[model samples]
Structure formats: C-alpha cells, structure tokens
Target: MVRIKFFLFSILFLCSSEILAQTENIKGKIIASGDLVGIHIINKTAGKFTITNDFGEFEIPAKLNDTILVSGVEYVPKEIIVDDISMQAKQLVINLEVNLNVLDEVVVGKILTGDLMTDIENSEAKREMNFYDLGIPGYTGPRKTQSERRLYEAQSGGGLVPLNPLINWITGRTKRLKEQIEREEIGIAINEAKAKYAKVIFEDEPFSETLQNEYFYFCGDDPSFKTLSDVGNELVMLQFLKEKLEAFKIHLEKK
Candidate 1:
C-alpha cells in the first residue's frame, strides 16, 4: 500500500508539471489614447480570455507560439504570437491602431414648390385679416392713437387712478413667468428625450454599466440632439436619432 501511494504521488506531480510547462502566464499592457479599460485579450489556442483593467494591464494564459487576439471598441483588432523571448520576458506590450471606417457620401436635393417670395405673398393673401392687419371702421387698429387711448381711459375712470402702467407691469411679469415655466418644461422634455433615445440605440447590445453610461452621454452630445428635442415631434426625432446612430456606429468602428 505504501509503494502504491508513492507511485500515484509521482504520477500526479509529473502531470501537474506537464500542465504548468504547457501554459504560460502572459502579462501585457495595452497602449492607446483615451480610456483603455475593458479591452479584450483572448488566447484562441488556449481558449482563455481576460480584459484590461483601468490601467490597461491584463494577464492571460498562453502557450508558446499561440496566437493571442487583442481588441477594443474603438481600436482595430491585433494579433500577437507568443515566442521564446516573450516567455522569458514574461510580459508584452501591444499598441492598437485607430480603425477609421468611412461612410459613403450622401447627396440631398431641395424640393421647390414655387418662387419663395411669391408663395409667401399668396399665402398671406389667403390668411384671414386680423384687427391689426385690417383696421376697424371706427378704431385705427389694435393699438389706438395715444389721444384716443387716453380719452377712452378717462371716460372709463381708468386714467384717474393711472392703473394702466401698473396693469402693464403685472402683465409683463406674468408673461415672463410663463416663459420661464415653458423653458423649464422644455428642459425636462429634452432630458426625457435623451434617455428614451439612448435606450433605443443600445437596447439590443450587451454593454457594461460603464459603457452604457458613456454611450448615453455620447448620444446626448450629438449635434442634432438639441435641435431634434426642441422640434418635439416623435417621428422626426426618431428619424434624426437613427441617422445619428449610424454616424455614431461609424465613429466607434473607426476610433
């Protein structure tokens, strides 16, 4: 029984050593501009994978002459072959290149209905005449002459108290307050639009939390975003988002 146990121990030791000899711990650093976090380091031969940390450093199991693939969202994929020198050094450094994907040029043409000024004049002719556009028979227009206004105010007892200026002040303040409220409501609507568009863009992708946040901000920073949000038409906003998404995809592919 003692002899059998010794033989088994020897076989186990040999197997462990063989396994260790076949696999190498490859430490690597990814060098690039911007954040290098979450870059994937894969050893296809060994079927092992790892990712870069915040510092752009990673470690993976590889074997001599094994092919290792390094890739990131904003970079071109790179391949490295492990060799004796790398194994001796126990470390490697990879520099990734920006993969710029160019999109096809688009040509847009204007649709003309008629001469712009003529069309405006014709449309104006069709519009109903308001009090200001067409003066009343007895009154001059929406704004009466100063003398006429004062005479009317005097007859109504409004001129005695001089409440016209005070009423004007109150009306101006009310107008300003309404405008402020409208601006705040528009701001809230814009934020909601950004969130909704972000969900639509990345709904199908499996992204890390950090990446999701980054992408959400990226969508918000799109040039057309503010304009589309201000327009406030869902169909138009959706179309604009789709176009922006295509551009963003190309940016990511090329970066």
Candidate 2:
C-alpha cells in the first residue's frame, strides 16, 4: 500500500511539472496599419485575455502551440499559433489587417428638360426667401432688429447706473455675447468628451495631432456622441466611441 501511494504521488508531480512547462507568460506587441490600442489578445486554450496599451504592447499568459486570437474595431480578426521560437524568446508581434467593405458606386446628375420657360419659373420659385420665411425673430414684423435693440440698450444705461457706475448693473440680451457664450459652452462639452473617450478609442500610434483634432470635430458633430456624452457611462461611451472611430477611419480613408 505504501508503494502504491508513492507511485501515485510521483505521477501527480510529473503531470504538474508538464503543465507548468507548457504554460508561459509571453510579452508581445500588436502591429497594424493604423492605431493598435485597445486590441484584444486572447489565448484560446489558456482562456486568458489582455488588451494592448497605448503603445500597442501586451502581456498575456499562454502556452506552446496555443492559438491566440487578436481583434479590434474595424480590424479583421487574426489567429496566431505560438511556436517554439516565440516561446523561447518570450516575445511575439502580431499584425492585424483593416477590413474595409467596398460600396457600390452611385452617379448623380441633373436632368435638364427642353422647356426653358418652365425651368426658369421653377428656379425662381426655389430661390431662398427672406429671413421672415426662415422664422428668424424680429425680421418679419415691427419688432426691432438685434442691432437696434443693442443700440437702444446702450443709449439707456450702457449696463451701468449713472449715479454709481459700479452700483447698478444692467443686463440685457446681447446677440454677440450670447453667441460667444454658446461657443464657449460647446467648446467645454467637446473637451470633456475628448478627455473621457479619445485616448481609449484612438490609440497613440496612428492618431496624430491633426487626426485627433479631426476626431474631436467629428464627435462634436455626431448626434450619438452628444447623447453618449450626456449619459456619462464610461463603458457604453467607450463602445460607442469605438464604433464612431471605425466609421471615422473609413471616412478618412475615402478622403
């Protein structure tokens, strides 16, 4: 019985050693044509996963001959097999390809009819009307224009009391001031969105200063971005931004 117990223990030790020998911690970098940040590096057999950092570098626990699956937004998934050389070096570099879907070409052109009089009448009717038709305030009726209102305000008090210039403050509608405030608010909101999501969505490798600026503008104009930014959920925002970045990348490529 004692001999049997000793044999079982020896077998268990050998199995454990084999398992440990097969598993290794591999450090690697993800290489791609564009940004590599946030790419997923997954060890299929080991059931381990990691994400690339700003530098596209990652470390994951894997084993020899294990399959590593790499994926990212708008990038085609890649499968890499761990080899003896990679295991010995404790390092690997995986490359990913961008998957761009081709679209059908569309041609748009004007169809001109032979009737000159009818065309002239139609063109005249399509001409833009005055501000009244556009629903602009004070442009349709007897109401004063914005400039007239500001002139009146200036004549009245100039935003200060005559007796004491610092005592009484007059505040009224100033179109220029209102426009400036609106611009400033928009700028603040855009910066906040950028601070929250830009780094993660647009990795450090391919996103340069100009590209970053363009992304900011693109997000500012996107309705979904506005909604996500207001909700303030980091995870959802990250996912949404990733989708938007993919679309933005496609747009850039087309340009």
Candidate 3:
C-alpha cells in the first residue's frame, strides 16, 4: 500500500512540475544581404537542429532558459537565449556580418572549348554571353552603342563583323569581361570558390566601397584597383541592388 501510494504521489508530482515549467514560442527574422546564405538552428535543451526559411525566418518552441542558435552563409552565426519569464513570447532580429577577405581575392575563369569568340558566345548554360554584359539596374546591354550589334554578329556569323578591332577595343578591360564570362558560364565565381568560408566582414563604410565597385562593374565599367586607389564615398542604389545581389547569389548556387 505504501509503495502504491508513493508511486502515485511521484507521478502526480512529476505531472504537476511539468505543468509548472515555463514554455514559450520564439520568433525571429534573419536578413542576409550581399551573398549566398545557408542557415542552421539548434535547440539547446533538446539538442535538435533545424534551418531558416528562404527569407531567413525561424520559429521554435522553447523553455525559458533554452538557447537558440542561428547561422547563415557568408553571415556570422549568432546564439540567443530565451528569457520570456516576464514576457509571453519573444521576437529577435539578427543581422549577419559579411566576409570581405575572401571577396577581395580573384578566382580564375572556367575553361571553354569553341574558338575564343565561339567559346564566349556559348559560355553560360543560359547562353547569356551578351546578357552578362548588360549594364546593371534596368540597363542590360553593351557600353558601346555598337556592342550589342557586334555580339549578335559574332553569334550568328551571317553578320560577320571584323573581330580584330572589336577584340582590340575590349582588350585592356579583359579582366572585367572575363568576370562576366564566368558569371554567365557557370555562376558567380567568387561565391562558388568559397562555399564554406561564409561570413560577412565589411562594415558599413567598407561595404559601401565594395558595392560601389560592383556598381561600376554592373555598368560595364572596369573600376580597376588603380582606378579605385583613392576613390571615396560609395553611391549604392540599395533598393534594387540589394535584391539583385541576393538573387544573383542564389542563381549561381543553383547552377
């Protein structure tokens, strides 16, 4: 009889304790700009793991003292503890840092088969040889009025235009053009090169500078290292550019 009573008391105590434990829902947003993003979430007590959605939002059921960790590609991982004792639920906004050192490096171009021009013509799986050079923003074409026409001719051969002068005209800017070829052919070379080394490094100021360089490239202007030697003050039309970079990163990763 004593054993049965003790067992019943023990069960009742456990059930009551469980009911008394604090439980709360955690909600948060993860905003990752400027790079391909991957995320992982961990529940401290449960030792279970999950990931953020495409928009980088996460929700998990947690106890008052439980910890939640968030991580993404090219963005720093963050750990947050649940403290909803006084509050019912919690909301958090996480901003990840960018990785700059890796961004500064130049990755070599992927090789191609056809003749130099033919190779350039059929480079990307999407066959976006010309599209890649389209200026950034709403502008998606050649810097020169004749650039598009020449590209068309090169592709069709029927509009056979002289190649020597065209090559000469675009020569000094080979590095910039090459970067486009890689983007069109495979994807953003930089993102692919450092898939695992994902972290944001540049602060606001430096980030602005880097973006300005991207803008220059977007418009088909090769703002070489020398050209940017003393350049200051970066102008970024953030509204569209932000979306463009994120979309572009995902596109490359998919390829």
Please report the candidate that would top TM-score against the real structure: 2
lDDT for each residue of candidate 3 in 107-185, tens digit (9 for 90 to 100): 4664322122222222221211222355544543335434434444443422368665466446744445444453443
Residue pair clashes in candidate 2 = none
**Candidate that beats the other on TM-score, 1 or 2, i.e. the better one:** 2
Question: lDDT per model, in order?
Answer: 0.60, 0.63, 0.44
Candidate 1 Cα misplacement greater than 4 A, ranges:
1-21, 104-255
The best-first sequence of candidates by lDDT reads: 2, 1, 3
Q: Which structure among the candidates has the greatest lDDT?
A: 2
lDDT digits (tens) for residues 1-255 of candidate 2: 999999999999998657645767899987778886777665655544557888899988766777776767657666788988898899998877786747754635432121222222222112122345657775223455455555445445443444222222344344454555445545666787677556555554488878887877776677676666555444455556666777888889999
lDDT of 1 by residue, 38-91 (tens): 676656455445568889998876667777777676776677989878887889
TM-score per candidate: 0.34, 0.35, 0.30
Instruction: Report the number of clashing residue pairs per model.
Output: 3, 0, 12
Worst 10 residues of 1 by lDDT: 119-128
